[model samples]
Target: MEISVKDLTKKYKDKYALDHVSFSILEPKIYGLLGRNGAGKTTFMEILAGHILATSGEITINNENPFDNQHLIESICLIKEGNNFKRDLSIKNVLCIYSMFYPTWDPDLAEELVKIYGLDKKAKVKTLSKGMESALGIIVGLSSKAPITIFDEPYIGLDAAARRRFYEILLEEYEKEKRIIIFSTHLIDEVSLLFEEILIIQDGRLILREEADVLRHSTCAVTGSIQQVEAFSKDKKVLNKKELAGMMTAFVYCRKEEAVAEGLKAEGIPVQELMIHLTENKGA
Candidate 1:
């Protein structure tokens, strides 16, 4: 399964929500879409899911345009942040309605997920707690078995334990069935380990796309005297920097060899701190 976006653009009023974005997603890997609020991640996902039309350019899944194409649409499922269903319907009725839409819906899996999430099938959607609603969303997403599953902040109302369970179940299902999953979330560090690749959108632009391991390996932290840190960071992309008294610490993002060689000379820096450095720099 391959999803290709070519010169995709989405505009609202005079502002470009997604500016000529292009990327290809190919088979069986989990991708993490990371960005700050209003950074175009949602726009891109909506376009890919065929929920909205792009202002210009094209998006194709398996060489077929996703927009208004029922065949392609059935193979793709998107769980958005606030996917509101009929508030009066019971959870079971909601699942039943969704089951008719997806060709690959798994009834057993949905039942199991309901049990795992501690959701009451007979409970009305309006009466269920916020966390329960999110769990229902998660259950539907996982059981749908769509080739392209896109989750946009699906764990919004989930507590820490519920979120952890969602992650575990997601990975377990992924391993069992090799499917393409694209997830957009602000909780980068919490779910970074599940991503095979990371796609970062910054200010309505595609900033970086790379393998997750490579991304982690490429960034490092250098802490020392202010002068030493400054000298070491020269010509390097310093994602973030801080000073305490006369000492300074810098998070340098560069090629592995470059960061390691420079760090060795300055003093060996720990790799475990790379995510913190990169995330801090991303915010900055």
Candidate 2:
């Protein structure tokens, strides 16, 4: 299930939600789609899920277009943060309807998750709380078992424990059946370890796309006196820097061994910090 996007663009009346974005999802791995607010993450996901069409350019899976393609839509299960179910239907009905929609849906998994989440099948969707609804949405996403599963902040109101359980289940399911999972969320630290690859969008443009393992091994944060930090970071790619009490901390995209040889305190940078440093305002 390879996704190939070539110069994909989505435009509003006056602004571009996605601007000439192009990338390829070539494997069945968990991809972290990261960016700041209004960075076109949702827009790009919606376009890929066949919910909307791009204004210009193209996005295809295995050389087939997604827009208005029912067969293609069934292969992609997109669960948003909210509004994934009908407000008037009961929990059972919602699950039944989705089961019919997705040919690959697993009723046994859905039933098991319902008990684990403590959701009442008889309860109407409108009567459930925000956390309960999130659980239901996650159940649908996992049970669908689509070739391409995209989750866009689908755990909005879930408690810490429930959210943690969801992550566990997600990993279990992925390991059971390796498929393309593009996850878009603000909670990067919690799931950063699960990400096989990372794609960063900023102001509607694709900025950074790299293997997580490579970034984890290469990117470093060096902390030392101002003179030492400055000399070490002079020729390196510094993503971020700060100075406090005559000491400087430079978040750099460089080798850790080099910084360590200089006697500076160096550590691998987290994915959350990498995203922040890469997308931060350079002019400010």
Clashing pairs in 1: none
Model 1 TM-score on a 0 to 1 scale? 0.90
Question: What lDDT tens digits, residue by residue, belong to model 1 across residues 119-233?
Answer: 8889999998888888888998999999899999998889999999899999999999989999998786688889998887766777778888777776766677788778878
Scored by lDDT, the top model is 2
What is the alpha-carbon lDDT of model 2 when measured against the actual structure?
0.94
| TM-score for all models, in order of appearance | 0.90, 0.98
lDDT of 2 by residue, 1-284 (tens): 88999999999999999999998998899999999999999999999999999999999998999989998999999999999888999999999999999999999999999999999999999999999999999999999999999999999899889999999999999999999999999999999999999999998999999999998988999999999999999997888889999999999878889899999999999999899888895531
Off by over 4 Å in 2: 282-284
Q: Which candidate is the best by TM-score?
A: 2
The clash numbers for all candidates, in the given order, read 0, 0
